[model samples]
Each structure stands twice: as C-alpha cells, then as structure tokens.
Target: MTRVRHWPTLAVLAVALALPHFTRGTQTEFAIEVMITGMFALSLNILIGRLGLISFGHGLFLGVGAYLAGFMLRHLSENLFLLLAAALIVGMLVSALVGAMVLRLGGVGFVMITIAFCQLFYVLVLSTQTWSGGINGIPSIPRPKLWRGTDLPAWLSLDSEFTFYYVALVGLVLLVYGLKRLDASPLGSVFSGIRQNAARMRALGYPVRRFQLIGFVMAGSLAAVAGALHASLFGLVDPSLLFWTTSGEVILMVILGGVGVLYGPLVGAALFLALFHYLGTLTDHWRLVLGIVFVVVVLYAPNGLVPLVTNALGRWRGAKPSARGAAVALPEDAT
Candidate 1:
C-alpha cells in the first residue's frame, strides 16, 4: 500500500527527467527556463510555503550568483561544477548579510525592504559597468564539458542547447528529492509550526528569527544554483537579472503551479514556459494573454495545476473499484 502511494510520484519524476530526449526545436530554450524556474520556485517554496515568509528580493541572490559566474569565467576554467560551487558560496555569503538586516521586519514591511535592498544592489552593479558590462551583459560563456576528456560525436555534444535542458532537469530531480526528504523530517515540522504561529513558537522556546533567517539563506543558496545554471546557459549576467520583475515572475510561477507541493513547481514551470513561448510567438502582447491566464487559473484552480490534476486523478482512481469481489460474491452466500 505504501508502495502504491509512492509509485505515482516516482513515475511522474521519471517522466519529467526524461522529457528532454522526447522534444525538440523551440522547446529547447523553453524547457531550459522551466527547469531553472522549477529550482527557483522550489527554493522560494521553502520560505513562503513552509516558513510563511514572503520575499520580494529573491532575485538578488540569483543575480549575484550569475554575476560571480561571469567574473569567474575570466580567470577560472569553465568547469560547470566549479562555477556552480563558486556561485553558491558567494550567494550564501551575500544572502547571509542581507538576511540579517531584513529578518528583523515582518509581512509587507519585510517585502518592501527586500525589494529596496535588491534594487540597491542592482544599482551598485550598474555603477560598475566596466566589470559587469552594464546593460549589455557578460557574453561568450563557454558551455560545460560533458565528460572530463573523452570527446563525443559532434551530434552528441553537451555544448548544444538540449544539453542545458537535460542538465536543468537533472538538477531539479536532485533538488526536489533533497527537499522532499527535508519536508518529511522533524526540522520540517518545526518550520511549519513557526509558520503557523511564530509568537507561540517563540514562547515555546524556539528561535523563530534564527530559523527564518536560516530558511532565507538556504532559499537564497538554492536560487543561486539556478542562477549559475542560467548564466551558463545564457552566457550573460546583467542588471535585469536583479530586477523585481524577475522576482515577481518566480513568485507567480510558484503560485501558478502550487506552493507547497514538490511536483507543483515542475508542472507550473513547464506550463508557464510553454505558454510564454507559444503566446509570445503568437502575439507581441504576450503579457496580456499571460495575465488573463493567471487570473483564470487563480479563480478556477487556486491550488495550482498539480493539486488539481492530482485530485482529479485520485477521483478517477477511486471511481474504478476492483471487480474481483463481485466475481467471488457467490462464496459469501455459501458461507
């Protein structure tokens, strides 16, 4: 029975991880963004869903990570692993400092302060146009090597667009697995408790502020992972990376997919990217169409697509009862 309960989730993951090999063309870029966005949304979920904190400057970590990756590319080798590590370290250090200051605020005050801080950082980056390349963005970032030294057939190169798609997918799988395990742990329970009633938690002797700060730092670190991957994929870092619009977009993605569930972000990201890609290609007013879709989804499916689909599937599965009992009904009368 336990296995039955878990199989569907595992199966969904397997299919998602395998998606890159099955699609081609415009899907390459869209898919890559979805994967990266999935990570971003999941990281945000830890704070918003588990800790009940809203962040409006999450992109600051992402932008910092990306910028660090760009800077490292100049002096260091273009190894994906090294670049990701550097981004994470720098991101965590920056977020640690920023979280200390912002963690003192609550609710709307917290949100606004976060946004202001991110903008401040963004302006500072812009001021250093010589190093950050200003609005033009860093360019020509080398793609990650697939295997250390063995060369592959030209067609099977990881330097291609599809490679980023698969890398993002793999990263999502690992991130979700780790987060799910954490969600089921005792730490997760305490986090949820804090979210439900921070004052009570403090009275009960929990360090609410410290826990929240840790959550923020962890969320920032995970977001940096996504940003590092994005820099690698896009080969650039710019002021736009720290824009509030980017942070808003990630929040929307989380809400559209479902904030609390592990699979919700993946489903939301895929749908979000697909819509953005097709709708943008169809008309210049893509945001208008997207806004309408967002309204409809919020109104009709407030829990997001994952929960909605899971609920529907649960009903369908429940509606189909076993037929074995009916076939053996005669035995009941005999008894």
Candidate 2:
C-alpha cells in the first residue's frame, strides 16, 4: 500500500530521467551539470546534515577524483568502472586521514582548517604544472570506450550529449536512492543521533569519532563519484575543481535544499543550475542575482526551500477551511 502511494513520485522520477534526452547542446549540458551537482550536494549533506560535520575541504575529494580519472584515462584503462573504483578508494582514504585530524576540532577553527587544507590542494595542483598543467588545466579528456572498445550503440556513446545526460541522471537517481536507504538503516540512526547530540552519544558509549570518520569517508566516496562523472562529462578537468568557490557552491546547494532529506539537494541543484544557465544569459551580473537569492533563502528559509514548501502544503491540506460563522464561543461568565 505504501508502495502504491509512492507511484506518483516514482513516475516523476521516470519522467525526469527521460527528459534530458530530448534536449540538446547547452540545455543538455545544463541538465547534466544539475544532476552531477545534485549528487555533490547530497554527498555534502551526508556530512553536514547527517553527521554534523561541515567540511570546507570537500573539494579535495572532488578535485582528486577528477585528476585521478584523467590520469587513469591517459595512462591506464579507460574503463569507467575501474576509474570510478580507484577514485572512490583514493577519496575515502584522503577523507579518512583528514577526518581523523579535523574531527577533533570544533566550530570556526575546524572550518578554517578545512579551508586551509583545500587551499593546500589547490596550490599543489598549480605547482605541478608538468603533471596537472597548472592554471591551463587538463583538456580533451576522452570519454570511456563502450564494451572494451567495441562499437557502441547510439544511446551509449559518451560523445553524445543526450547519452551522457541520461547516464548522469541514472547515476544520480541510484546514488540518491542508495543514500536514502543508508539514512534508514541502523548506522543512519546512530549518525543522526550523533548529529543531534554528539556529547550524549559519547556518554552512552558510542564511539563518536569513529562514526563521524566513517560518515566523512562515505561522503568523500560519493563526492568522488560525482567528480569522476563530472570530469568525464566535461571532457576536461582543472584546478577549478579544487577551488574554494567550488566547495562553497556545494554548501550553498545543500542549504538551499533541505539537508538530510534525500531528494532535497536534487531539487535545489536543479533550481540553482537552471538559474545559472538562464539568468546568466540575461546579464553579466548573474552572480549578484544568485547571491541575493541565496541570501533570501538563508534568512527566510534556513531549513531550505523543499521543507518550507512541503510544510506549507501539509498545513493547507490538513486544515479545515472554516465557512463564515463556522466557529462559536461561549462567554466565560455563563459557565
């Protein structure tokens, strides 16, 4: 019965999954960016929303995954699966090591430290001009060959914008659903509890640090997936992946969507990217407009657009609209 009730949602997802194929050029590129950024936001949510950790160094995972993908494509196999696995493993290890150190800090200090770490990575990319091409960045990254170099179907060609869009859509859906399942599991309960009250959980004998580190690693792994896809989709990767603004964008995305809700970031990403795509066409000051919108969302709906809208709709639906004179009151004196 519950499954039956969810059919509408599933139908919506199906339509979204198919919608990108009909578009071409910039529209398709925008759709793919939305999907990939949505995944990145979700990965951030795992840390900020579920585990109560705000990592400003998340670009490390993203940049690393992209560079790793580029390196693998150049030197090793172009098999997408192999590249993704390698990227994820590297990302997890990077996060685990960083988490072990940063998890001990709290508040603004931690944020500063993470930001510093991200800057460190960015500088390294710039310094390795021979390997990473410095500011020029890697370009013309090849798309993965289908079926180990066999002839590809029209639908499976990464060279086709539509094919890549659908691939990213499917990947986002799968990852989002997987995150939802994880959120419902016992481990998720512990993570949530830790988010709400880390001290209380510590008092109750939970290994708080361990749980946090694991959550960090999970988030990093997912972010790496997004990063790898993004690199393949763009057919390029650059130091911009390690930029502080990149991390800031992901943070804004999670905040704009209600964090901890599996689908919220997806919605937020779509809206955000749509604005960047369309509004950027109108003026050179699109960043100003975006900044204003973000400020409004933060001030008025800190829990995010999805939660605010859903709560309003729920209230409206649950309320019984009173007809004229529907309510009567007796005087207290009469009682």
Give TM-scores for every candidate, taking all chains together and pairing residue i with residue i: 0.88, 0.91
Clashes of each: 0, 0
Worst 10 residues of 2 by lDDT: 326-335
Question: What's the lDDT of the predicted structure labeled candidate 2?
Answer: 0.79
Q: Indicate the residue-level lDDT of 186 in model 1.
A: 86
**Predicted candidate 2 versus true structure: per-residue lDDT over 1-82, tens digit per residue:** 9997678679988888778767778778887888888888889888877777777888888998888888787778777778
lDDT of each: 0.77, 0.79
Q: What TM-score does prediction 1 earn? A: 0.88
Report residue 245 deviation for candidate 2 (angstroms).
1.3
User: Candidate 1: which stretches are off by over 4 Å?
Assistant: 146-157, 161-163, 319-335
In candidate 1, what are the lDDT values of residues 1-335, reduced to their tens digit? 99987898789778866776888875677678778878888898887777887788999988888887777765575667777787778778888999999988887778899999989988888788888887787887766655445466533444776666767777887898889888799888888788777888889998888888888888999988888887877777767989888888888887778767676767777777777778888998988887988999889887777676766676687854222111111111100
